[model samples]
Target: MNAPRLIVGLGNPTDQHASDRHNAGFWFIDALLRHYPGQMRPDTKFFGDVGEVRIGTQVVRLIKPMTYMNRSGQAVGALARFYRIDPEDILVAYDELDLMPGSARLKLGGSSTHNGLRDLTAHLGTPRYWRLRLGIGHPRTLNPGQSVINFVLGRPSAADQQLIEQAIDRSVDHLPVLFRDGWEIATQQLHSADPAMQAKKEAKSSNPKEEAGEKARRRAPEDA
Candidate 1:
């Protein structure tokens, strides 16, 4: 809704977890930093690596939590409190297992399967912040016996990884629209399947929840 917002990318902070599906948040931020080239430095005070980038004069602080995935609240809560940023002024990006790989959805509120989100919601004492859920897909879809923990901690196949990266790449183009024009514009432009149909589609909805629900269309495992 305003400038100088905090954009947190969630992930574990270790080399071993670097390429795991659970680290999709890290990968998303990595792609962003590569595109925008922020001069990120490890900030002990923030308990994470902090950096800034100006998109048409709006300063967006990009943060990669160093507290690991399970304890993201430490870094996120500290940074937001220090900066006096409201919960609505923050946007978090992370992997989602329920959607197909190469897909992405931006919305507000909680997650069903992400521990990082649960930690964040707990620390913030609310689920009002925005979220960019990058689909990494579920490994159990391909194998019934695969454990969700093992699937997320394990590295994705090269093909799946590329798909996830591409999804992030496409989603990155809407960062400016999201920060400047807010949620509706970001969702309409980014989530719509066809550019020509976006305006017509947006005209059909006034509620962000309805819009996100209709557009996001949460997909669960058929067997589950």
Candidate 2:
């Protein structure tokens, strides 16, 4: 597979949404800009903030949709269609509620209950693109009776935010592997470094109650 030509960070584009868990994608993009020499500027044609950075030999375009979370695809679709970039060569980074904070996954396909991803697939016409699922964790798992909408739109706790930021850094560090090597190797390298995933595995193996809680958490609805 070709190295990704476009890397999109899915998030609502407003100051109000900046620290929300739903803006994990934006946070990742910000982190990337810090590590790689790049600047984000608003582009009307793309309906988003667009930028680029060279990784190895690949010039990867980065986008942060200016549209709200539900309409995320509009900006992505505009930029992607104009560039004639194939869906397979696009990577989108967004938050995930299923995994615990401090864990992230790189994978292709599967939108699950993520509205941003669902809209992205609708516009891109396929779910074949790569994804960086930065785990924000579910409210039901962390705090009982909290609504999904409130949980996602609200800022994460200080400790959780630290974990999420750590996860973002880890994901950013492995981009070279994803672009230079391939999905299989990158997935192995990325997943192997996820401490949260390892902790979850240990909890599942040693504590049935914790495993059951995890299952319930997955089954809970993510949208309001």
Candidate 3:
């Protein structure tokens, strides 16, 4: 693959879920749009918000699927098929629970924790694409009783949120390398750095309210 032609950030589209941990991919896209100053409009054919960004002389298509998160493949598959973009020439960004908060990593292949990725893999029909994992930390680290769904769908503490922002900004700063220098080079640079502005992780419980929400989400659908 040459440079990535399409970049998709996974998230739910509702305003209510805008600041949730699961929306980190959307936040990354929002940050990218702000940096590039492009028009991202809703397109029914794509079933999502679509835009173009020039990263190192390449005009890359950006996608933010409005099809919630579970069926995000519908949007991704549509665009990929339309553009005939190979699975290799694509990148996806989404939240990760395995890494501790304030950390981020770039890699290829499947991260099984994300349902959005599951859909993308099924739709794209390959696991050979690049991925950016914005660490969200595990729920068990925050609180033992906390469920995975609640941890991902809930908003992080203000301090933690700031750390996430720093991670996003740091990733954006490495875009030139990410697009122009190939995934391996970009991954090395991104994985090696310690985030300079990453705020401190908070010392607190996941709270009783979140535990309740956790049960609800588990009973409901996947909140990728």
Candidate 4:
């Protein structure tokens, strides 16, 4: 697969949403700017802040849509069309509620519940673009009574934010590999680096008989 040429980070505009969990994408972009030699400038034409950075031989463009989260497509589509960039050459990073904090996943061509992504797809006319799902966690799992809108628009707890920051840093570090080595190698490297995921895998790999015995005991009460 071709490496991405344009990377869009989905988030709301303004200082108000800066630290919100919904701005995880913006946080990733900030982290990327720290790692790469680039500076963002406001581009009225694209309706967002745009920047460029060299990743090895390729020149990659970065965008943080100022159109806010729900209408992010307005900015992304403008940039993509002007550059003649194919959907395959675009990668969008945004928050994911389904994933736990500190965990991230990279995938291509899938539907999402995110309004930002949905609007993006409408503009691009395809869902084939790559996506970097940064986990901010879901309210349903983290706080049973909280609504998703409030949870995402709100800031994460300090502990959760720390984990999310680590994930962002890891993702940003993997971009060079993604640009030079391609998706498979980059994805594997990124996913493997997630400590929480590794721990879960290790737990699952423990003694099967012991695990089975525990499951059996739990089921015994139901069976009785």
Best of the candidates, TM-score:
4
Question: Which prediction has more favorable lDDT, 2 or 4?
Answer: 4
lDDT of each: 0.81, 0.91, 0.85, 0.92
Error of 2 at 57 (Å): 1.1
Q: What are the TM-scores, per candidate, against the unseen true structure?
A: 0.83, 0.88, 0.84, 0.91
lDDT of 3 by residue, 1-224 (tens): 47789889999988899988999999889898888868689999999999998987889999999999998989999999999999888888899888766777878786585899999999989888888889888888875799999888899988889888888888888888877787778877887674532221111123666667667888787655
The window of 10 residues in a row where model 1 has the poorest summed lDDT is 215-224
**Candidate 3 wrongly placed segments (more than 4 Å):** 195-224
Candidate 2 achieves a global lDDT of 0.91
lDDT of 1 by residue, 1-224 (tens): 55338888998887989988888888888888877858778999888988887775677888889998888988899889888889888889898888667778878775455789988888888898988888877867844689988988988888888878888888888777776787888877778743224555666576677777765555434434
Model 2: lowest-lDDT 10 consecutive positions:
215-224
Q: Mark the regions of model 2 whose C-alpha exceeds 4 Å error after superposition.
A: 200-224
Better candidate by TM-score, 2 or 4: 4
- The digit string of per-residue lDDT tens for model 4 on 59-143 reads 9999999998989999999999999999999989899999999988899988888999999999999999999999988998898
- In candidate 3, which residue pairs clash? none
Model 4 lDDT at residue 5 = 95
- What's the CA RMSD of model 3 in angstroms? 11.8
Compute the lDDT for candidate 4. Answer: 0.92
